[model samples]
Target chain A: MFTQFFYTLKAYKVPVSLTEWLAMLQAMEKGFAGNNLLSFYYLARSLLVKSENFYDQYDLAFREFFTGLEVPEELFDELLKWLSEETLKRHRDSVDLSSLPQHDWETLKKMFEDKLKEQKERHNGGANWIGTGGTSPYGHSGVHPGGIRVGGESNNLSAVKIATARKFRQYRKDVTLDVRQMKVAMKKLRHLRRSGNLLELDIDESIDQTCRNAGEIELVYHPERKNDVKMLLLMDAGGSMLPYAQMVNRLFSAANSVNHFKKFRYYYFHNCIYDHLNAGMEYGERVSTAQLLKNLNSSYKVVIVGDASMAPYELFMENGIIDYYDRNETAGIVWLERIANHFRNVVWLNPNPPRYWQHPTVSAIANLFPMYQLSLEGLESAMVELTRKAH
Target chain B: MQNFEQYCGTGDYIASRALQNDVNVAIALGRPLLIKGEPGTGKTLLASSISEGLETDLLVWTIKSTTKAQDGLYIYDTVQRLNDARFGDHDISDIKHYIKHGKLGQAFTSPKRVVLLIDEIDKADIEFPNDLLTELDEMKFYIPETAETVSARHRPVIIITSNAEKELPDAFLRRCVFHYIQFPDAAFMNDIVKVHFPNLEEKIMKEAVEAFFSLRELDNLRKKPSTSELIDWIKVLVASGTRPKDIGRELPFLGALLKNEQDYHQVANGETDTRSIRRPSFLR
Candidate 1:
């Protein structure tokens, strides 16, 4: 189930990981964790995501993977608004609202007021006007006049005035709409307020929207117990390893993404360790296996998966990379030995078949690690292995 | 590599068990193992990961066209012998004592066992595997002038990989184990994608991954994108500041992931104008 959610995110380019899945699972297990969510949101932020953010991502995962449910539309729309706002902030820094024409600005503000009114109406279940039974998507955006002394009786005039001013200020020439277009655009904007773009969904927006659709959970905020698990991944990157490299990278990224929510460390290694597989120079990305392992606390799990069979000496030489950077430095197998000692809960998943260990190179390398050669055909074996250790 | 717990794999067309068993057995026997597969099937990562999983030193000696058996092992200072000969009073035994440690010699002599990876052995001449006969079998080498045998304090784990461009000799192959690495199935590939590129959005992950998988066919392409390339694509997506929902520009970057220029051209041409392939309605 978690894998499905992970996959869904991967498919959409959301980049979910096993560690984050675990956290989401934990959050679900605990029912509703407001604090865990806060942490989860912060964690997702580090993924370099800003639109709907981690809250939205986690919400989508929660609905789809855990409860086997989907979030509601209203909440989803709120998140979508955030997504649009963030997207605009990211790409339209050059489009300053102060530079727009006065009339266009007024029209835009009026459009915004209409949108706010529409959202409030939907939130109020077609307009009771007082506090709605459920939480509003724009909880404190100052658009909705909650019963608590809003300093105005009948917010219609103020809403229109403020929204019109805001819209006018934010108006851009390149993003112009003619008078007739504005009428259509206003209707569309209202529609967006009520229902997001069904045709072209921002996946991140959709995820955020879907999450908002989940409404509010009975959230409890607190710190989670630190898990004694660190995941180290070794991926085959270039050459024959390249085809599956994306998969491996995604898997690693999934684990990394999931780990972002949790507090586990990870390491990356390339083909068979013969000479020292320098974790530092891998993918031109800076990470040192030596530094990670040395500093990493024990009580963690290490997993290695790859095809496992290469040239005969790939197992015996230094610098395991097929194409050496500068020198013919072969990665030594000693590197694996070093990593194995630091973490004991190690398992190897072969992207190859179990029968194929017949190859001397595969066998030779498999000899050193706790490996499970999984058939690439299904998830059963992988599922079994991943949980069997605990069972 | 064995002892993997955190490795998430990618793809949906994995090989059969017959190939994997060969790899496990070879690792157990400490024999020189040779792996074969098409490009992008993850041939090299297996060798490196095994060494990493074992926590052993991995020495990858990538075979070149000029690579020889001696290149697989250690290349002693025969040149230093001539250098020493520059002096009139060079002793034969003393010159032999100056034997420099080649990759193989270092492996055979080290206190700690090393993982020696002879990557792309097929790229070298046929003589490459023939040279491993003595050192691999007995784990020992003899210096003729010194008249002494340097045996293995520890036998380095040996793994050799080839893309099957050329078949090795019977004798050389007989000494090693073999496995054919292939693209993984969708489920496993999903796990793989999750493992490495954790921060990317799932929506694009699946679509782009499927796109990558589709490229496995179409003979016009030269090389297939590997597990590494997928991670890179994800990175590109993330770094390009694209939303999890937006990956329209991602097709052009496929050139980075696609191995064949023709395949890339095909994808580039078909995708650039088609707008639908580049930006599906569901995603946009």
Candidate 2:
């Protein structure tokens, strides 16, 4: 019955699995959700959605499946309150349903449909119909203990108003990455090697030696593995990159906070890397591009963050540096090419969306280095690219 | 089949209806409840609440960055065995003597049902959750050294909390029931505060909660004051003999709330208009 709901969740890219759907069905079959739509909503959500990151998508899917059902917020809240109270009372008193009139599943479903139609036609005054606060066997706040409470009220909106709220929209991964998420992405760039002094005991080797020595104990120690990856971050600062300053700052801080790297260095450039890069934003210690290329070996993974948007001449022509005071002997593209050639792994993170990459400068820079969007998924892929072996 | 007890909110821990429903569903289904939330939203406290409410034993396993999944199952004390062999003081031949059961193993071996809380599972390596999938699903772990399978006498109610530090693998997540503990709204926060400080005057509680929410609403604050923080702040306010009317105005003992220096300064410097604190449209 819920297969279509499963498909709807998939359509919304919620990543719900058949296993989860079956689990929710099993819970429902066991009467875990009882006859409450609110309880059912929580049950399905808890069972089917694995991560809060996909919660907004799940909410959308749920709303789509239960569209045209908007229960008044106050009424829904009251129903939830009443249902919880009823469940608590049931638990306390061990409510027995054998005394109540019972009907088979098909009869109950048909009765529920007929009562719903009657309630819609009558509007108000139906004490024995599928409406609230009545002895009708089909709706909540009624005295029928054994009857199935219809999931939603007709004429009124459905219980999906909760789903339509979309409270988890902030958690969507497609949104801009937060500093903590950025740090998590940066944490994946690990190239561990046993470079430190021997400290950790090699248990297998020690056990082997003990056995060979006939009951004598032997200890073996080896150097602990350490992260040997060195990262060189070159970011575009000022001018066109102004809009993405906060995002770029988050990336910079995330990288700076991750202390696992063997060596970490950052420099800023206005439009592109020119004769030298600023050690800080616009004004700071100037490290000549030649010096950076000479000092940092080819083994260093380089990440360049920028919008990659600029006048075509600024990238292609000599002395086309954005800062008029700074005269560059070589074109911006040539400097980028030098860095790309020098580094074994290099990736450019464009703050602009992939669609904007069609611009002349962005595409030109894309040709020089593998460019990725600055979103969480993009950063993750960029991190993957940074760890990939050079072809 | 054994009857699974439902976990209503305990006197001390005020769980919302949705949270209570999710907890009961997870308990009934016998699946590990994976909880994600902002720090200090009572994720860890829920495990204790469940154990207390169900009248069962509680076992906690705290995860650190260096924690391995194997450490939670059973730690084979091979080094102890080796040391015993050298000293000739203990039974070195029997591998069972060297086997030390971890939190999970203890929970599995317990005579009665227990609540097992894996606190901050995300602090461990990303593969940590995946490594324990089989054990969590089957409720058993086989120790090759001892040649014995330790299966659960009763499937312990497992609650795993994540700070969302790292994204867990899909395979691991698929095996568990998940819930995100939304931060409590003002009304819910009032109940939570009353649970901690029952004797607090209604006026002071109202003003303190209002002040706390206003502080949380301030933009650019590094760390927003959570429920626990609000409780502490109210405690300080009551203890300091602060007046109810002076609660939001002076924000007495602000240190109990805002831990970050910048957040404290932002609230103290009158940079934020506390009086005009806009409540979010959706309270629930």
Candidate 3:
């Protein structure tokens, strides 16, 4: 069994040596690994793998070698069935809110609460279930008047608040997003300051000083160039944002690499800025909008990234924050206004096409803030607007 | 037969049984143990501990973003050779004279088996690991300029660490044993604290530990306190002769725990009780 596994790793180009194989066999003779699959996995990796780079390969080989012993195929089939049913149920639960008469915030809230009380089992394609694709004032993906989206993609941003446990891939700062167009766009935020430790040789200073000192040929030193602009980026993560992941990731990576920002701080939110802004999904750090506003000075430039396509109520509904049902007297629009007021230079970067700018929710947001398409031209114009002096 | 717990003398370092087993397997297979963890989880210390336990010399090769794979194997000094040839220097004809054995070459040529630690493999370029694949697999590398292949005299116990700053190529990750060092829980943290502060009063230690965990558990903190940071905070508290209950009162020392401005303001402004903050409607 060990030999076959060893052969498997070798086939994967794990670079296990004959002597190393002998050593592993010797360790096994001493009863190193018991019947535990995890223990065996650890044992195999330690002996056969030499570099951290091959760990993923070792994992694949180990899983391949130990197939049928771990996860059962029947279990997978059951899981798939459960997932499909859940999806179908969610789809069916979505009520056509457009067909129903539009209700005021209070009435809709009251109806939503009553529906929540009566909802014993998951309902779909119904008038009342707080599930997706239905007009029920509480779930996502279906047209609903004054509805709160529970879990699913947002088409009409109708939800006062969104709630889901879905995880999002973190925007990797280390990955170089070196698209030439993005780089060109990033130049707008460039505010370089040469300060700190001496990094680059000051050629002009050196020559001037040398000439002044009777050609002593002494070299002068200047500090490294640093970006002095303070950029505060609030991004939309998850749901409809999933389709625009690559574009957002590119933007994120480019923004980080620009290295011209004296201070670059990023916080993630969904759809609109609400009461609390999440530091990151993985980090799970929740910062209150009040706290964030207080922390950042008015000098900081704020960039809001989102499609801005949601129900108009989402912007105006009290306690209508979509991710969670937090009942605040002030709505999301109030929070947006407060943030805009606090920051002297604020711009909204919409990844959604300009054709979608006519979206009720999107247009409403564009009116309140300077909205720019997330493109080379849009970024350039946004930066020009931001850099424009009081005159 | 000794485990990592034993290897990390005086400090337990939260060495899980799985990690110990993987190290043992690495020893048995003559393969490198690749450890991935968040920053400040004692990834680098593991290599030193293993070397100390085995009583072997440790050869460390710290990787930078600019570091090339050629930096690990060997460097052929063509310029130096050319200069020597022009100056009619002796041994200009000998290619060996121009060759400076790099970290890997030195480890391979060592008479005794050494512990080779390749720290922060993710810092290097995407091609860095792939470039070393042939040498790592075969335990030998050929110098194109020298037209000579140099092989390992003794198989060194290799340990590679990554913070996962960059995604390593699938081909490179497949060649090694992988272990993710998880964040220590409150109980596991107690053991680590005891190792660091043996004479700390139980009351003070418990309070400090509770406070540490509370701070770490806080969902509002961007940078969570790691094991080492917790240890440092405790050390400061002990040095000041502060009682366990007073740990929270010393607001000046709060910098040790909460590193960020927002975090400091949040805690200092009496927002430590996160439960008061509303959760999502469904979650509530």
**DockQ leader:** 2
Candidate 2 per-residue lDDT, tens place, B1-284, comes to 34533788898998887788888888888899999898889999999998999999899999998899999899999889778878988978889988899999999999999999999999988789999999999999999998999999999999999988788999988888899999988888988988898888999999888878877776567788888888777778878899898887777788898899977775676534357445432111
For TM-score, the strongest prediction is: 2
- For model 2, the superposed segments whose C-alpha errors exceed 4 Å read A69-158, A208-216, B1-5, B270-273, B276-284
Candidate 3, CAPRI quality class derived from DockQ: acceptable
lDDT of each residue in A325-381, candidate 3, tens digit only? 455668888898898788888999998769989988898889888999887567767
Alpha-carbon runs more than 4 Å astray in model 3: A1-32, A36-38, A41-391, B1-14, B82-91, B249-252, B271-284
lDDT digits (tens) for residues A76-126 of candidate 2: 443444333322111212322223465655787676666545544322112
Q: In model 3, what lDDT does residue A335 have?
A: 91
| Candidate 3: residue A50 Cα off by (Å) | 13
Candidate 2's displacement at residue A59, Å, is 1.5
Better of 1 and 2 by lDDT: 2
- Fnat, model by model in order, equals 0.00, 0.84, 0.33
State in Å the error of residue A257, model 3: 6.1
TM-score of each: 0.38, 0.87, 0.51
